[model samples]
Target: MSGILETQQLTHIFPNGKAAIQEINLSIKGGEFVIIAGPNGSGKTVLIRHFNGLFLPTKGKVLLEGEPITKDLTEARKKIGLIFQNSDSQIVGQTVADDVAFGPENLNLSRKEVDHRVKESLEAVGLSDLANQQPHTLSGGQKKKLTVAGVLAMNPQIIVFDEPFTGLDYPGVLQVLKQIVGLHKNGHTIILVTHELEKTLAHAGRLIIMEKGRIVRDGEPSQLINEVELYGIRRPYGQNRSVETMTWLS
Candidate 1:
């Protein structure tokens, strides 16, 4: 129960009978900032889907705080928020505030409570003023922030991010990265999946590298990812991209 999550012999096979991930054994402690790095189709997404009971393992069980994933995921998901990479796919409302309120509303919270969560989450993401703005009108970085705010409004104990920086400019990428650090400092357990090793190494406390549906290495970011080829994993971001450690500037 101490660890936020635990998986035993987790395997995920598509309906077409192709195994996306096989025999994954991982444990994540509370308030840990763990990032999963792999190439495209490495099953990072599939693996994360099991974290909050989105996808059950084909041959094993996923434990969230020692509870097995089940049909009624409400109790478990309240503590584990999953933030997709695309805001458009996740957003359900027109305005930023409305989108942030969706999750709390579904939880059956009172109107006033939902309002407070929306306001606080927006402010945390530095988008308090954009509450009235339409999600489609916001920039790529702002949209990502809105998506993050939506997840935060749920008041989750742990958050799973799937490639938070897929299509963003330099500033846009920095914006999400800043929020990640801020959330971690605020005592939120974070598991982020990304392909950009340089950006990830800059913020992640622990790094996990996966290849061919299994974790080849897991340790401090500076230790393993710096010498990726030593573990037989592909280099990311155009070969040997490097960045020093940085927290949010403002």
Candidate 2:
């Protein structure tokens, strides 16, 4: 897989003159499952927002397929779908089916095409049976899956999940983790941001640890697993287990 998403000297500064992310360069190849972990205030969220053009860079540029993302914000967003940490914030439609259809509808797709996407997306996430149910009535894990289905409906090539497993119970975490792994296995590039590594580390091909406003480490999970605690992320392995066994899924 070639480089599908990239950042060049990317930096984002808030209105108060605080730089959330400093000059950082990164690349994400197609179909790679990457885990980005960091402590609070490490700029993980700010960095991923630039990928979808949600937050423009303050100093440099973000590129999608070798072209600047700013060149076409619409195309950038369509190809790079973002699932926010809070599922409630992403829920807008009165029902599950309507919420999943929102993205395709906003793109002005034909009614037939929108219906097709909604059906396929929901099926992909195992929410087809709940199509007519209210989104608020779903559980936390189900809500996360709903967000994933919404993003899938957009036909995104790269999916950026920000703290996907947060606020989930044991079963909920497993449910969402299975959905994420399924997405990666089906050839969608996955960039997952979270401080909790044990829950999903085993499935990631690469690991990136961010500190303060810069990328402190980037490489294979096993190579950097030992050093994650230095940056305030808990080490998930012990003598009985290794990086490959650090996941919650069986």
Candidate 3:
């Protein structure tokens, strides 16, 4: 089968003449869990943003399936859900349930269908009971989960997370991690862009690393993550790795 997402000689250069990513050729298979890691400004975000058509390439093209992403940016955006790094920016509705229903309602889904999706999405994120609460009143972790629920309500085929675990304590990370694993098991393609590795390595099959606007390495997470710090990422020391292993296995 053709890859669900592909970038052909993908290159992006800013107006000021700084290159974000250069010649990035990549293919993402359906249902695969991929980790895109790099030091700050290694082009991880620049590359993935092309997948969903948020940032079109300056020189090359991003393809969804065999077709160029530029062909149908609307459909591509619907298929690829990007959960931004700042969870707060994702929240739009005043109430929790209202927020979760935003995407489905925008799709022109019937009221019953929209309600059903809102219920299911909230339940999936373990926030069903908080449906009637004010979204602004939720804690940081709950807000993140709410952000994910909003995306889940859209029912996208591919989910790309940008710095998903940047903020949050241990339990918060575990909560989000569990949701990500569950989504993958249910057959959603998962692409994660994060600098921290130790807690997430066990959950991913392939690792792609970027440095200086170019791909430095792409391989198994265990092999690539251990050596990624040379570029700028630290693999989360002072925390026991065994716990993360258990998180994935459980």
Best by lDDT: 2
| TM-score leader | 2
Quote each prediction's TM-score: 0.91, 0.98, 0.93
Could you tell me which 10 consecutive residues in candidate 3 have the lowest summed lDDT?
240-249
Q: Write the per-residue lDDT of candidate 2 for residues 1-250, one digit (tens) a residue.
A: 4388999999999999999999999988999999999999999999999998889888999989999989999999999999999999999999999999999999999999999999999999999999999999999999999999999999999999999988999899989999999999999999999988888889999999999899999999989888888999988858557887676776
Question: Model 1, which residues run further than 4 Å from truth?
Answer: 230-250
- In model 3, the runs with Cα more than 4 Å from the true position are 236-250
Q: Compared with the true structure, what per-residue lDDT tens digits does model 1 show for residues 137-205?
A: 999999999989999998899999998988999899889999988899999998998876667666677
Q: Please list all clashing residue pairs in model 2, or write none if there are none.
A: none
How do the candidates rank by lDDT, highest first? 2, 3, 1
Q: What is the lDDT of candidate 1?
A: 0.84
Candidate 1 global TM-score = 0.91
RMSD of each: 2.5, 1.1, 2.3
Give one digit per residue, the lDDT tens place, for model 3 in 60-170. Answer: 888887899788887888889999999988899989999999888888999999999999999999999999999989877888899989999988999999998877887
Query: Looking at model 3, how many pairs of residues clash?
Result: 0
lDDT of each structure? 0.84, 0.93, 0.86
Decoy 3 TM-score against native: 0.93
